[model samples]
Target: MALRFEELDFQPTPMGEISLRRRYDPAARQDVYEVRLGDEYLMSSLFTAAERALATLALDVLDAGPDTGPDAGLRVLVGGLGLGYTAHAALADPRVAALDVVEYSAPVLDWHRRELLPDTAGLATDPRCRLVQDDFFRRMGAAPQDRYDAILLDIDHTPDHVLHPSHAAFYTADGLRNAAEHLTPDGVFALWSDDPPEPVFEATLDEVFAERASHPVRFGNPITGGESANTVYVARGRAAR
Candidate 1:
């Protein structure tokens, strides 16, 4: 009998604890998980700077206004819990009264419990944190008990992703309209995109939100060293005009 040496599907990476060799599926015409590092970063992932920065900017916008009552109790709704960087940043803010993290994938949730996975258990287990394991839309459909000061979403790699077609609706005019319906007055809706969308989309946001603004942030040189551009959409959810 000889020792077996080819039965593994995942490998280890220097930056994170896990990695995998992607497999190609002819049916889906999509690459399987040949290799996957941390949700935070991937060798082929060039948007780390944008993702974290978007979270930071959203928090900044949420906390910009004058402080009110002693217990204003800031509440935040995070659409997707990636590596928990956004949640971690939110937890750092003392103003945040509660953090509602909605993640669709269970594997990602499991990983968060691990020490290598950014130690999200601290937030996950926090009394103020509520983990909802369901579709974002379904969760939103339920009447919200407490209106949030901010709603930050990063559900997909981009608006043009083929992996999840339904996600397209999540970024549509109607979708934004529903998002607006859920926000508290003066609250902002910040969406993360790999690249800026067409002007029509901004117009859609303006249709629902009062004040609209877009921020373009380029981080790291190799990606933006030559001819490249990336941005995030920061739209303040305004009351009906």
Candidate 2:
């Protein structure tokens, strides 16, 4: 067998230089697609369990109970379009009526539009999904009241580790309050953190939402052959104090 390698696209964005590449991994015995921001590995197709969980875990909380029908026509806002795992996972649920994905990188969106990442390209054509080019944090602040049933984020590395300094505000008490405005009463807000659960961030969530939970999703690391975990912070939106 021969090795496969390709640099699908590369461009300079407001954030920095971004590149998309496709390579075949012998250990994983599969083709993998990756997106990078300069020297940082933004996302990979090989390890997507946590990204997918970000959607499922949040939506599950909104799932209908015995007395209620399915939470049909659910509207969701996904903060990142990395490889489309989260959006795809959200659309997997029959109840999801719409998924609005806000991505700050136009090149990233172009990659999906051109099908550079085949597995994730389906998102572009999915009737339930909409790809918007904009700053997620800004859009969240400008969003109308009760505009979304759930808001799923995977933009930054973590609440404390942000790619851009401006993003730090989103994790603060006031920043989170702006984001909460977009959520329906009882709406769900879930964020994907590359690191484990942090007490400080959890405390911030408690301050912003009436109810919240921190979920540690563990998955087998193909390269390490051991379990690695990511934190998914889920909070229920409530009227501002």
Candidate 3:
């Protein structure tokens, strides 16, 4: 059996130290990519069901609308770029015309540009995708009104468990309201959570968006040989007064 070794690219950011690593798993017989913030494991290629679901579930609900057409030119904003799964999933849907991905880490963006990760699907060069080096929460707050048809967020661990202290506010009523301002009237906002459904967070979404849904995505945890689940929270933007 071959030993598992990781090729790491480390960088220092305002938030903290961010590391991108690629490792070969002898069990899976494939390469797995991972992202870490300091010593915290942020994301991994070994488990991406919920990450892909973040894009699929959001777009599926949006596509159900009567206003959506073959050439609707749907514009989407993805809040994270972990392995480009969300962005790649968004592009998989032909209805998506433009996708703007906001990632705070420059090295993560560079990994995609250099095609260092095992799966990029040409996300850096994709005609429909643009990778922006910016803070997702701040960008959402400052974006123009009705700027996006959908917003998919997966930056933090969860609504209650955030990587940065400043991000905690984004989960509150005021913060969500600010994020909602950037969405079209019928636009969708979907977020990925490491934890299961949280009712308190759901209530906040209801207060801000007026309508929301929670989907529990369950998948096999290869390392544990058991099932694990995550929550994908989707909400509709409230109409402007």
Local error of candidate 1 at residue 186 (angstroms): 1.4
Candidate achieving higher TM-score, 1 or 2: 2
Q: Estimate each model's TM-score.
A: 0.71, 0.93, 0.92
Using lDDT as the measure, name the better of candidate 2 and candidate 3. 2
By summed lDDT, the worst window of 10 consecutive residues in model 2 runs over 63-72
**What's the lDDT for residue 151 in model 2?**
95
lDDT of each: 0.63, 0.87, 0.86
Tens digits of per-residue lDDT, candidate 3, 1-241, equal: 4337675688898878888877777666777888888889998898889999999999997753234564358889999898888899999998888899999889889989988876765999998899999888887668574478899999999987898899999999889888888887888999999998998999888888867999999998877778999999999967343
lDDT of 1 by residue, 47-109 (tens): 355666666777787654346764366778888776666677777777777778887765456
Best by TM-score: 2
Candidate 2 positional error at 11, Å: 1.1
Cα error, residue 19 of model 3, in Å, equals 1.5
Q: Tell me how far candidate 2 lies from the true structure as C-alpha RMSD in angstroms.
A: 2.7
TM-score of 1: 0.71
Tens digits of per-residue lDDT for model 2 on 25-69? 878888899889999989999989999999999999995422345
